[model samples]
Target: MRLEAVGRRYGARGPWVLRGVDLDVPGGQVLRVEGANGSGKSTVLRILAGIDRPTTGRVSGRPRTAYVPERFPPALPFDAHGYLVHLGRVHGLGGRTAARRAERWLECFGIAGYARTPLAQLSKGTCQKVAVAQALVAEPELLVLDEAWTGLDEDARAVLDDAVRARSAAGGTVVFVDHDPRRLAADTTAAHRVQDARLVPVPPDAAGGPRVVIEATGGGVPPAGLAYEPAAPGTLQVTVPAAESDAVLRRLLAAAPPWHIRSVRPAQPPTEPA
Candidate 1:
């Protein structure tokens, strides 16, 4: 999906919240958007998620989208499971399939016990898990999150982190805005910041200086958002910033069965174009 020169404003004469925003959201990658508070970051996400429309230009090829906004209505009448199933159906899932997926994600987030509890009765942290679960129940083609991890507990947060990677690896486009700079920083395929009412690219090394090369083998289909090249017959090379090397390593080790590390060292200088 792509946003072409998109801009948004509250009223006919209101000042623009976003202007000349051009973004290309590709499949099979995790995209991170950053900006200071009140910098129109949420506006961009809303537009991308189809919650808000742009006053100028257009968004094209948007697929099945699911959004987790900063604030969720806690007083909703339905229980967590029912709400998720409803959203799943809204996203085109059949009744049985939606119910099955709802149960699965609730279990994954450690909230299976609260499946029948009313949204109004759940604790704040538990409600946040519901919010995250609603978006993932149908396996959306585009997942948009705005501080979705803010209220999650440690285990739930880790589950969400893995969920984001899983979504991207399954060929979905995941776009997120989180206050924590380290949240998925290493796994991001691209980063951008909302600035002066415009979206601008952020260099890969902006988060950390220099880069490190990680060579490993036996990890099938490296986690999405990481760039890798086949090395030896059974090995692959992944280059990430030094500061994010640890996070990268953790991701590798966190995978089921894990990866066998062959080496971690400074990346060699890039070769000049002929």
Candidate 2:
């Protein structure tokens, strides 16, 4: 899908929130949208999700999409499970399939106990989980998340992270906005920031690149949003952008029973084919 010269505003004479925006949403990738508060990030996402139409340009080839807005209204009349099931059917699932998926996601997010509780009775964080679950129940071809991680507990946040990766891995497009720069930094295929009422592409290195490799030991768990795997007995290897290497090192050293650094170096670039 593509947004061609898209622009948006409120009233006839209201100042533009976004103008001259162009974006491509391709399958099997993750796109991160960034900007200061109220800088039109949400507007861009809304347009891509087909929740709001562009005022000036056009969106072409829109796919089956699901969106999780920045604010989730918990005043809905149904319980968490029912809301998710309704959304699944709306997204073209059979009744039995919708109910099954709803149960699965609620369990995955550690909210199975609250499946029958009314939405308005759930806490803010639980409500946010319900919002996210609704978007995921149908396995949308395009997923747009606007600060969908906010108010989620650590475990639920990790669950959502896994879900995003799963969607992208399954050849779906995932676009999201979050306050934390580190959220899914490793998985993002591209990034853009809203500035001066327009969308600006961020260079790969500037956003997060020129990767760094860290060899370490003794840290029980590596930091969140980093790519890592076992290297040797009692040791692990982590890779992240050079820009975030320092922060990663600090986190390792600050952990209880701090991790012992084996080596820190820039990851070797791929060799050209002969």
Candidate 3:
């Protein structure tokens, strides 16, 4: 997906939130869009998602996409999972099929217990999880997420991290808007920070992968950008050519069970270890 000189401003008298921004996001990889709140990160994502039209410029890669906004769309009086089932059906799932998928994701996020809970009674975190599940239920070719971490607890966050990673691995394109540097810079091939109404690349090393993993408290999903396969009983391994292990480990160390780097062995050792 690519944006060419995209710009947008709300209201007749408002200033431009995004100005002359250009970005190219390749498929099967992640693009991290970073900025402070109100810095146009979400605006860019919305434009990409077709939720909002950009005031100026062209955005390619509409349709064939799924977008999860910062706050959820008003589902009014339905139960949380019911709303999700509705969204899933809207995105192409049907009847019992939609309900099944919605139930699966709610369970994955540890919200299965709330499947029958009304949206109004759900916590913000739970609501946000449902909102995220709505976009993710269909597994669209292009995934756009905005401030996706809001209101999420540790477990939900891990579930999200894994889904994003899996999407990228399956060759789906991802555009993510995030204020947290960890989320922005995690396992993505390209990282851009929005400032002064423009998107700029962070230094390559600074935007690199996880550098440390001290411990993993709970088991969930891993971060994006690396392929890890079973190495030994109770162990998994990953190696990235032309990328530093320490850099990747650092990002992995900061997250929950899976992102937690249990140990850092030498990247390359005597032939016997392999």
Candidate 4:
């Protein structure tokens, strides 16, 4: 699936959430979209999910996409599980199939007890789980999630993480927003960040490449790091050039001193001939 030069606008006064956005996400791949709070991240996801059409652009793919929005019909007059069941049916699943799938996801997310609980009575995290399970229940070829980790406990989070990996492994594509660099350090995953109203590459750590872990921000996403994992404890690294060492040091201090900062070192020089 891909979006080419997509753009959207709410009204004359409304700014274009997404413009000239180009994305190419193949099946069996995880494409993470990350940014500040209102950089049109959600807007872009919705467009990909086929919920909203781009104001000016083109998208091509026939795979059934499942979108788990940030908000749903919670605190309403409906049983949480009941709503999920109904949603499954809407997605072309029948009684036996829907029930079985819902049960599995609920159990996986540790929310099976809320199967019959009222939607209004469930916690924020529980609601989030239900929303995610709904998207997965359809067994979609494309999964579109908006802040999928919004409200989930560690256990539940693990379940969803495993599910995502499993789905992608099974030839599914995923486009979701996340603020955790640690969670997306896998080699197979490719990430992009929305900044200056555009997308930029977020290269995951690959072998010896030095990367910094920073929770800095410019616009949309929250305080999240965009650096590679440190190879060793007390080692702070970054992908930027050595010329920016001072800036990187400042940001590191802002993120909090490393467990042990023997000293700040510039880029390592290559060894000469033996």
What's the C-alpha lDDT at position 107 in model 3? Answer: 87
lDDT of 4: 0.71
Candidate 1 C-alpha lDDT tens digits along 46-110: 99999999999999999999999999998998999999999999999999999999999999989
Give one digit per residue, the lDDT tens place, for model 2 in 1-274: 9999999999999999999988888898899999999999999999999989878998999999999999999998999999999999999999999999999999999999999999999999999999999999989999999999999999999888878977987889999999898887667878999999989998867744588899999867664444578998879887778776776676678666789999998899889999
lDDT of 3 by residue, 13-65 (tens): 78988889888877887888877776777777888888888788988865478
TM of each candidate vs. truth: 0.91, 0.81, 0.75, 0.73
RMSD of each: 2.5, 6.7, 7.1, 10.3
| Model 4 TM-score, 2 decimals | 0.73
Best-to-worst ranking by TM-score: 1, 2, 3, 4
lDDT by residue (tens digit), candidate 4, 140-218: 8988878787678888776776667667767898888876644534413687878767776776432344533332222
lDDT of 3: 0.74
What 10-residue stretch in candidate 1 is worst by lDDT?
219-228
Please give the lDDT score at residue 74 for candidate 1: 89
C-alpha local distance difference test of each model: 0.90, 0.89, 0.74, 0.71
Clashes of each: 0, 0, 15, 10
